[model samples]
Target: MKDSFDDPPPVPPSERASLPDGLRFAFGTLTVLPARITRWDRPAARTGMACAPVAGLAVGLLAAVPGVLLLLLGGGPLLAAAVTVAVPAALTRGLHLDGLADTADGLGSAKPADAALRIMKQSDIGPFGVIALLIVLLVQTAALADVYADSWVRGALATVAAAVAGRLAMTLASREGVPAARPEGLGAAVAGVVPSRAAVAVTALVTAAAALAALPLGLPTALQYAASVLAALAAAEMLLRRCVRRFGGVTGDVFGALCEVAGTTALVLLALG
Candidate 1:
């Protein structure tokens, strides 16, 4: 099977994008945000993946608002946590969750790569997909509820950190050397577009920022937040490796699975902390 997408025609240096263009691409592709993407070439994908955390941050903040308001209005922590979890799904139109379900079905099929990929592309969810979605959503909601019970501020910070961590996984997944499982669609467009060094730099920046965001809580909390980010990435990495071995590389479904895995791991760690 082919391991990568067929390259598009080379873009001229003069036609390359700036940072803003990349931001547009990130927001445009990653969320329901109104940002218009002006480019779709590899350079744009590189910038977009590098800026993915920024898009995640925006999504997190927006999602956090309602939960915070509900808490301020005396809503219970579980209710608040549910809303926080629901908002991101609404914003992304459940794209990631659907991806998670599809990926689960694919992996669970246990057939060869091509057969597994076909299973993933099917529209209907299978038993594995349903079970995976149920478990992940339950874990995310339960963990977040516990965090919210501790304090709303801590809960909000965890939500944001998880969101950022999820996108950070995408950045890492896009790093050069990762292959696309297919030769078309989102996986091909983004896979291997980001330089490894750039992905590392983005990861460091995001980890530092997450720790700094929790500093107001205390040094221990800050360190815990940093650890959560690392743990989240590690979880995502394990899944990515498995998908690569099982399916030959990544697809849109794999990316979605990575995001959810990372986000859930971050939330679980934050609750434990």
Candidate 2:
């Protein structure tokens, strides 16, 4: 709620020689916008995954601004909520949503893990994917609208919480115990990249910050929302386990689904928590 939204200046060529590599990679890869990337390396990948939440914070702040302005302009909460949902989708090129759809298609195939992975890999959307995306988007939109109608402050907080929740889900999806479902692609690149201790630290910090930001909802309610964030995190973790069991391990698509699932789950809870 009280942090800089400013993007850091590009690293000078001189500084690039000494600066850490993965920081820029996170922004460049996670968000649609351009960020200077140095050579790709395992350390860079690890750093990128570890600092994933910073990307969440940046985009989350951006996503909330339009909604906050709409509220102040008396444009009504529904419009603001719709904009809030649309902003991230636009910024990320809807990759997370695509992932959610693909994951759903794979799981809904009701085939074995190998067969399901094949379904997920196909470019075309399946009925399961379509339905899953619709439900997730509808629920997120409705919940965000309700919060915006109640309090713009809480609505803004919800936006930020959702962003961080997604990134936090990334950590869960790429945790130590998880393995890449394939030998190539994003899942292979980032799986197990984030350190265990760092994941816990980031998750705890984000959940606490979410709690503090929701304080306007009253102390008891704030605590409930905080607990809900944890529940969302737990849910995301369990989802990753299910993916592992169902698909043989985590995949790039799985990471995207985790982000959407975790973010939506947290936002929905914040609506009523």
Candidate 3:
């Protein structure tokens, strides 16, 4: 599928020019590969918002590719889980993870939003960030370790679904009143146009399908997985609303945090089941 995250080859000049002005601008970021798809322009913002669900779907599929490859390699469950982590690292070049680390350092310091956001922008990671990253990674590693050991394919699917659903939460956060931390930052553009209800429905539907799909293949309890996704979404919504009230809206850092939180929630629920 020609999804947004595939990073397709550049469109021909004639085709690019022929697109409606809105689409040209909406997809302009594709030409730049990993560049921010959203800009301050209204057309781009709305279009970018509309495209986020597709982005989630594409990214999820891409992340799953590695896990399947590992399974084919006869790798054990732990190795298969590791491949799941590696896939996102390669696809995003660790950008979201960096956001996770930075946000941890900044938020853990208990500073005001402006000051904390400034800290996050610093090149160096602080002790808090490092510790937080370690804990989050450890949780993921452990959860996948168990899942893969039991059912490699189920573990792989869970990982992919979590990645997709988590980002949807982050994207939904951007739909509210939050302004980007930086005037020209990537998060600013995309965050502003987030479609809250649409994001919720899309994520829920995808996650539900993932849960059901896994059932025929010995995945975790379907009810538990469904509940986990719902809980994660609820938690993210509450957190995003708080952030909006406190700091004005979701930033890239918050988005990263949302991903981590949602992913962890899914894993925890799966474990309990």
Residue 100 in model 3: lDDT:
75
In candidate 2, which residue pairs clash? none
Instruction: Give the C-alpha lDDT of model 1.
Output: 0.92
What global local distance difference test value does model 3 have?
0.63
Q: How far is candidate 3 from the true structure (C-alpha RMSD, Å)?
A: 7.7
Query: Each prediction's TM-score against the native?
Result: 0.95, 0.89, 0.76
lDDT of 2 by residue, 1-273 (tens): 111233333444543322346668777778886788885655677768777777888888999999999999989999999999999999899988999999999888999988899999899999999999999999989999998888888888888888888887886666565688888888898886655666777778877887787777789867866777787788788888888888888888998899888889888888884
lDDT per residue as tens, model 1, 1-273: 323344334557876678999999999888998999999988899889889999999989988999989999999999999999999998888889999999999999989999999999999999999999999999999999999999999989999999999999999999877899999989999998877767888999999999999999999999999999999999999999999999998999999899999999999999997
Give candidate 3 misplaced runs (Cα > 4 Å): 1-40, 179-182, 215-220
The number of clashing residue pairs in each candidate reads 0, 0, 2
TM-score of 2: 0.89
lDDT rank order? 1, 2, 3
The alpha-carbon lDDT assigned to residue 160 of candidate 1 equals 95
Instruction: In model 2, state the lDDT of residue 246.
Output: 89
Q: In model 2, what is the error at residue 193, expressed in angstroms?
A: 1.6
